[model samples]
Target chain A: AQSVTQLDSQVPVFEEAPVELRCNYSSSVSVYLFWYVQYPNQGLQLLLKYLSGSTLVESINGFEAEFNKSQTSFHLRKPSVHISDTAEYFCAVSATTSGTYKYIFGTGTRLKVLA
Target chain B: SAVISQKPSRDICQRGTSLTIQCQVDSQVTMMFWYRQQPGQSLTLIATANQGSEATYESGFVIDKFPISRPNLTFSTLTVSNMSPEDSSIYLCSVEDLGRANYGYTFGSGTRLTVV
Candidate 1:
């Protein structure tokens, strides 16, 4: 089984400021990490994922996350934020070789971008 | 990624009644999953709907409470039974899109159920 933990419940930042959303996971085996964003009254959208190859992964929307194996962390970061980035972010984890597609999500961290 | 659609985007139902949510995928997928999101909470997997077999439910969820049917690769349905105020939440269906090298998952818009 895999579990994810997002340390911050809420993170507020000014527009154009850099920000980071912390996420950690516990798993006995190899795992796949993902970051999803949910806007108001909308379903989740995949921000990015870290499967293999590089420890760092990036999304087209200028968001990036680094998968740290030793620390069991996959923290999401952005150099600059926009008002549109104000949304709830969730961190998810899944076993890499379980043959099952079940994902364990964290409680979530609400990002508030101030203008 | 596959384009997915869910029916009845939002609904209000009486307690003890049941609602069936439909999910359709534009492309064929081998696996479909049902998830529930409580108010101001993260998603919880209810069951995995596989074609030609019984759905595998996660812990704390039962087949009777949340019955799932996957008759084919591109279509599935999830019925919430014996609803209560606590059962009011958003139900979403997701499918694994293997076309991407990372094998990411795509989710439907989600059906919001409000039981009164």
Candidate 2:
């Protein structure tokens, strides 16, 4: 069984300020990590993912996350955020060895970018 | 990634009634799943919509409450039976896109159901 933990339930940052949403997972086998963003009244959009390459992965929208195996963490970070960046972010983990192909998601972190 | 079109973007139904949500994928997908997102909560997998077979449900979910039908590889429907205020939430359809290196999942716009 796998579980994800997101300590921060909500995070507020001023426009152009930096932000980090932490995510940790517990799984016996190797796993893939993903970050998803959901705006108000919309479906979730993929932010970035870590499959098997370099520990660090980035999304086109200037957000990046590094997979730290030792710490079992995949924290999302943005050097600068905009008002448009206000959304709920979710962390998900999928066991690589599980053929079932199911994802276990974190509680989610609400990012509120203020002006 | 496959694109999903979900019907009945939103609805307000009476308690004890039922609501059937539909999802149609643009391309053939090997795996399609249904998820429920409660207010201010993360997504929870309700079941795996399997083609040509019974859907596999997750723990705490039952086929009676959430009847799923996947007639083909590109279409599926999930019906919420005997709905109540607790059933008021966002229902989303998802498909696994193996073509991507990261194996990311594509999600539907979600059907917002409000039980009154």
Candidate 3:
């Protein structure tokens, strides 16, 4: 079974400050990693995904994550954040092998950007 | 990206009643799933909605309590039977869009069901 673990439950960052949300996973087989953001009263939206060929995956909104296979970590990073970036982020993992296609989501990290 | 349209954004139902949530996708998808988000908790997948056959439910979830139906590739529905206070949660519909190298999932806004 594949499982995702988000280390931080809540993180507060000032505007223009760097932020990193940690995520780790446990899986026996190769897996795909993803980050999702959920704003207030909204559904979960995909931020970025690391499928293959790239250790670092980036989103259009200045968010990036690096997939480190040795460490079993895929941490999300941002050079600077804005007040609008305040949202709950989730780390999810799914198997690359065939037979199943269910995503295992982490507990979630709440990014509270203070102006 | 796939677009999912879910009905009844929020509903306040009395105990012993049942509520059905519907999800309509704009395009055909092979993977459609149902998830539940409880208060102050992470999203937990309820079941995988298959097009023709019976839905595959996760452990701890049963067909008698939460029945699911997928009539086509673009539509699915989930019904919560015998509503109770414990059933108060946000129900979301998810669909996957596979690309050549990568894929991402899209979700409905979610239906907030408050059982009283």
Worst 10 residues of 1 chain A by lDDT: A94-103
Q: Residue by residue across B24-112, what tens digits does model 2's lDDT show?
A: 99999866899999998999999998798899999999999999999999999999999999999999999988876647999999999
Task: State how far residue B66 of model 1 sits from its true place (Å).
Answer: 0.9
The model with the greater lDDT, 1 or 2, is: 2
lDDT of 1 by residue, B9-113 (tens): 999999999999999999888889999999988899999998999999989999999999999999999999999999999999998877657477788989999
Candidates 1 and 3 compared by lDDT, better number: 3
Best by TM-score: 2
- Superior candidate under TM-score, 2 versus 3: 2
Q: lDDT (CA) for every model shown? A: 0.92, 0.94, 0.93
Quick one: best DockQ, which candidate?
Answer: 2
Please give the RMSD to the true structure for each candidate, in Å.
1.2, 1.0, 1.2
Report the candidate with higher DockQ, 1 versus 2.
Answer: 2
TM-scores vs. true structure, each candidate:
0.96, 0.98, 0.97
Q: What share of the true interface contacts does candidate 2 keep?
A: 0.89
Q: Flag clash pairs in model 2.
A: none
Report the C-alpha lDDT of model 3 over B1-116, residue by residue, as the tens digit: 78899988999999999999999999998769999999878999999988989999999999999999899999999999999999999999999888744487788999999999
Worst-scoring 10-residue span by lDDT in model 1 chain B: B96-105
lDDT of candidate 2 at residue A114, scale 0 to 100: 95
Candidate 3 global TM-score = 0.97
lDDT of 2 at B51: 93
